[model samples]
Target: MNISIVLILLLAGAAFTFFAGNKFASKIALLVSVASFVFTLYALNLYLNGADLSCKSIWIQNPKIYFSLAVDGLSLAMLLLTTGLLPLIILSGWVTKFENEKAIYSLVLFMAFAMAGTFLAADGLLYYVFWELALIPIYFIALLWGNGSLEERKNAILKFFIYTFGGSLFMLVAFVYLYQKAGSLEIESLYALALTETEKTWLFLAFFLAYAIKIPLIPFHTWQANTYSKAPAIGTMLLSGIMLKMGLYSVLRWQLPITDTAAKEFMPYILGVSIAGVIYGAVLTLRQKNLKKLLAYSSLSHVGLIAAGLYSLTIEGFQGAVLQMLSHGLVIVGLFFVSEIIFNRWNTYTISEMGGIRSQATKFASFFMILVLASVAMPTTFNFVGEFTILYSLYNVNIGFAIVAGTTIILGAFYMLRMYQQTMLGETNTKVFADVTIVEGLVLLVIVVLVFFFGLYPKPIIELITPSLQNILNQIN
Candidate 1:
């Protein structure tokens, strides 16, 4: 598929710029990211027109794998999201003064390349490779450029790597066992395999382990807040915005359908824990005094609900899960960026020290308020669509599930609104606080526009994804 072109261009551009030196790296990365985004737009047009955009080439003969990258509406949506965010991520860091500017931009582009590849991969081995490839660049990005003491940053980033990588190993084992039994690595081929309920359960847990750590379900989530707190803003954006979605997307694409019988069997336990995460994360968010840590907990809370929607196995649930993924991706990027701007001015993350920022920077206050509202799933925001849909799906399963899960909105509002009022509304002792600069303003504006745009008109994605989701749903049954 032409979707592979995006990944190819990103990686090649990254390599070229790594040699292009600091003077040219950022420009090259931006242009390449723009080109990739344009190509995605062209591909999306073709896809909407019924063009054949799927491509597969034999890359391994023994144990059989393919350089198989396919983009139906589902894959294309993710590809578009990946490419769309790249230029913005690169541009977002334009003002940071780093020692190895070339390396920084290069790693950012490389991260995009890996993620785009993950979304496009249509073979198990190919997908696993792309999945692991994504972890390398971000690890260095956080380790070298991250804030906090070196020992602390190293411990946090290393824990993140080991925790996630360890889970991925189980996933690899599942894939290998699948390949051994099915004798092909094609995703569809593996999904079509008729396995016993017991076998399906094993595969389910294997895939779940990999996804849970990344999505960071309760006990599996210890690495996240620390990692987010320690990483640079750009690194945090990459983690919260795009990286978390990989697991959620995998749940939609691989885990559920492939383990359909087992998923049905374990639905209650899985769904229970996911819903529990919603409450757990929200309660912790209430206690957090660090700005970034609050955001970290907020992410866990939101994603927990999304995960519940996925396990609900209803059409509305899938719709909500996908829409919320996009919404959260856009919202978190702006939130983390907002944190960076605040830190740049105040040189502190302690929420107790921040007060009445709005009194000084009214423009920044307005932007921050809107993002905070979006994060809390306020009415008329993009998040509302997904959160409501997901909760409705939970209602389909059990009114109680929906009722319990719905507390996220209330708790989310309590924490986020309280934080916003404290940070931006009250009274700042500072003589003056700087407002958003041109680049920061542009970034927030783009995010705000998408929040309202999708909030008002999320149907395009529903239309695009329905056929693919229906196809998967059919297979599961």
Candidate 2:
């Protein structure tokens, strides 16, 4: 089966959802998400079983770009990540007490479709269109339904929208240059072009500025903490879980090949900046009392490691970065949702103000404990595999870098455990508290089970990524 149908199906689902209203919106959304997940699985099977599914249709004949969609090992991996987490994110929001649930539900489905389109689009212009399209639904979601003080939330959302869109302008410039140089706007055409060294360097910087802001590497990270902290739980999940990967994916798809020499030349400085982000983000995480702020900081630290991994330019490093992206996406969904549960119950997120929850709900405490351990990269969790791969890559690149980056493990444990202890281990500060509902328990359990499952057997993903890594690395020379 062709994968482009997935995008068509998703769009149909979004339209159906918009008309379905609140009563049927949730059920319709769930069904669509399940179907999308099935399609993702089908695509995976095609990829692994050696089926050919690349299809292209022209959208802008003048630009020579097509509404192209392909399912290669790399695109398939990202497609799986996009479609897989979506149902879970939708499920999390299914239980949320959102106003105008129909609109919210429809928007979620739309965002999923947009993300899937972004991942699968093979034409440069088409990909950028989907990339920008994905941001619109999220902007409204964050601005209207987010949790912070209204003015603060609006400011944060505005800043986030502006910062990312502003950065994307550079990407557009880079793409225009490629179209000029390659004589076609197709990504493959651009990949095949042999640009002068000077041209490659300039294009690389343009792409780098765009992605660095999306990844929000240290200096460009000014907007992330506030945006994440203020966004609604599901909005935050979409931002951290799937949106950030867009930037990283672009690095592999466009940046690396377009300017392999530049990547090699600037590896040391890029690596150093990434490590600095790791240290800087972790230190700030340790100091945060707000649950959301802490997670935001932790995200900074995690993405820093991924960035470093990519810059290492080793097969292991590239694979590890991909694994880390998947791992972090899952863990952050749980982490943010857990915080949402707490906010729903107690109406506060301050660690210092919460206590004695172990008695109130052993289930809550237990689930929190599992997520904490996973976040800190306890040996048996999927996070451990991500960290191990990244650190192993780092060790090969530079042992000192790995050692310095590894300190995040220590700091991660300290903050997570300290938060757990303060929030769940003290005397019963308040009598009224609720254990996780059955749905909450089931959600947490699934996440925990997957964490352990992938941790124990990452062979599947490693094999899936290896061919793609080899393809990319072959081009480096």
Candidate 3:
């Protein structure tokens, strides 16, 4: 089967859902997303069996671009992450009474289509196109369906759009330069091109500017908290769960190997900045009384650690980053869904306003507690494997780096437990709190199951990604 089928299914699904009318939009979107997930699984199966699912053909004759899609363990991992979480993200919104429901669901499917393309595209220009395309649907998703006053939403969304878009222009410039020097925009072609130290450093910084802003590491993270706070639950999920991974994926896929010298040269400085983001985000998360903002900053902190691991440029770092990407994606979506459930019931995002829900909503509290533990890297959760590997990689680089970054685990446990305590463990609330509905319970159950499943047996994921990561390391060395 052509790997492009997954993208076609989602793009077509988006169109179909939009026209299907409001009555069936959510159901249709969910069905299509699940079907896309099934197709992705089939592709992964074929890939494991060595069926060669990649496709490439001419697109533009002048610029010498190709409509290319390639699969390897790294890209496949990302593809799986994009397709896998989408159904749950859609299903999480099943009970939401969104105005213009058809439009909302349609955009979700479209965003998935673009994110999948971003993962699969092998040609640099094509990858850049897919990367930018993923932004459009989410822009609308946040703007139209977002909470907060209209002015607040507008300002936040506009800032997010401008920051991300502006950063992408640097990436476009880098791609164009690569094409000029290499005479093709293909990944292998650029990878083969030899460049001077000066050239490689410039290229690395250009790509870093783009990915850093998208990853929103430290100084570049200004747009994140506001955007996450104001955007709708699913919009926030898409951003946290899948969108940010684009930047991280591009780092391993494009930046490191393509500019190996510069990556080695700047490793310490970059790692330092990343660890600083970990500290910065966790400290800021501690100060948030708003649930979404707290989660947003928490995501920022966790993502910084992922970025640090990837830039460490070790095999363990690469493996850990990929695993954590998947783990964090699932866990953050679950966390955001928990927040949405609370808001739906209590009509507020204020952490201080919540209390004693555990007394009434045992199922929800149970689910939320598991996610909370997972976020803090409890030993039995998938997060523990990823976090342990990442910190191990940093330790190899420098004990100080590991020690500083390790504080995130300590700080994360502190604040996350504190948030859970204030929100769920106080005296019984005056208002009634219902347990999770079947749909809500189902979504949380799936996430929790996957978290523990992967946590216990990460061998499959490790075996799947190892060879591909070794290949990237070879290029870097």
Candidate 1, residues 1-477, lDDT tens digits: the string is 556677778889999889999998888988988999999999999999988777789998886889998888778888878888877777788757677889988998899888888888999999999999999999999999999999999999999999999999999999999998899989889888999989999999999999999998998999999999999999999999999999999998889989999988888898999999999999999999999999999999999999999999888888889889889999999999899888888888999888988888889989999999999888888999999999999999999999999999889999999999888876566646788889989988999999998898888988988888788778788
Cα lDDT, model 3, residue 91: 94
Clashing pairs in 3: none
Give the CA lDDT, 0 to 100, for residue 239 in model 2. Answer: 89
| Candidate 1: segments with Cα more than 4 A from true spot | none
lDDT of 3 by residue, 190-259 (tens): 9999999999999999999999999989899999999999999999999999999999999999999999
Q: What value does the lDDT take at residue 203 in candidate 1?
A: 96
What does each candidate score in C-alpha RMSD?
1.0, 1.2, 0.6
TM-scores of all predicted structures:
0.98, 0.98, 0.99
User: lDDT for every model?
Assistant: 0.90, 0.86, 0.95
Candidate 2: regions farther than 4 A off:
none
**After best superposition, candidate 2 residue 256: deviation in angstroms?**
0.7
